[model samples]
Target: MLSEQKCEACSIDAVALNKGERDTLLLELSDWHIIEREGIPQLEKVYKFKNYKQAWAFSNKVSELAEDEFHHPSILLEWGKVTVTWWSHSIKGLHKNDFICASSCDGFVENE
Candidate 1:
């Protein structure tokens, strides 16, 4: 499964995913969107919750997921929702890791 994939270490040789590659991989994540802000690409998804505590707990779980993968995401916490965007800052674009992280976040919501 996508979430089981591990992120690779950064290297001068690492390259960002091409458009076709990104699009193809995105097929696996139906709820995610590819958004470019200020010319940088990212995979973003918003998750709704029953209440503030549920959302907060979900955010914390995602934090643990990110730490385990060593690929963090930008998390926006709200009263009943959370927005997560995953991107490889070092590459200035999306990577397979971003998609994988996004998948794990989806799993968190699923198992909640």
Candidate 2:
């Protein structure tokens, strides 16, 4: 179970893991559509938009957020959707940073 101190909400949980524990956490989060391909935990949520323009706009918004936070995710953009994944490379494992990014990502979706 995730520790309450690390929980960013019911949806985002912060994990302190070393290199060895990373794979395990990544695997676990992957079960929820998150993956550990970028040397960290990742998730690609398909955001639906009414048109290509809106999709691009949303992608840009996410880009701005990523830049401001100094934590970026691998983004996959399609006609009407954008997929964002979060991970940390320096620690070689999950960190509070990931949860912070997740919370920010969640806010984007929640507010939209």
Candidate 3:
């Protein structure tokens, strides 16, 4: 499972996932969607919470996880929801690490 995997170091020259690979990995992440920003594809998901406190806490957890994995994401924390967009800036597109991190983020709210 993606959550069981660890993110590897992504260099500037690393190749992004092809369309087939991206679609396959995305199948494992039902709640996430592929979106384009500034012409770059990204994996994005909006997690809902009961309150702002819950949303904020979830965002912090994701932040800690990102730091641990050394693969960061663009996290937008708002009232009762947090939108996380993951992409390898080095490659300017989706990477395996993004799917892995997205899977981990899903785990954070499995009980919710």
Per-candidate RMSD vs. true structure?
1.1, 6.8, 1.1
What would you estimate as the lDDT of candidate 2?
0.59
Quick one: ranking by lDDT, best first? 3, 1, 2
User: How high is each candidate's TM-score?
Assistant: 0.94, 0.62, 0.95
- The global C-alpha lDDT for each of the candidates, from Candidate 1 onward, is 0.89, 0.59, 0.93
Q: Model 1, residue 18: displacement in angstroms?
A: 0.7
Between 1 and 2, whose TM-score is larger? 1
Candidate 1 lDDT over residue span 35-83, tens digit each? 9988999999999998999999999999998898788899999999999
Off by over 4 Å in 2: 1-32, 38-40
Q: Between candidates 2 and 3, name the one with more favorable lDDT.
A: 3
> Model 3 scores what on Cα lDDT?
0.93
lDDT of 3 by residue, 1-112 (tens): 8978989888767899999999999999968999999999999999888999999999999999999999999999999999999999988999999999999999999946
Worst 10 residues of 2 by lDDT: 2-11
Model 1 residue 105 CA deviation in Å? 0.6
lDDT per residue for candidate 2 within 1-112, as digits (tens), equals 2222232322244445665564444453322245566455554456778878878887887788678767677788889877776665554455655645555555565677
Q: What is the lDDT of residue 55 in candidate 3?
A: 99
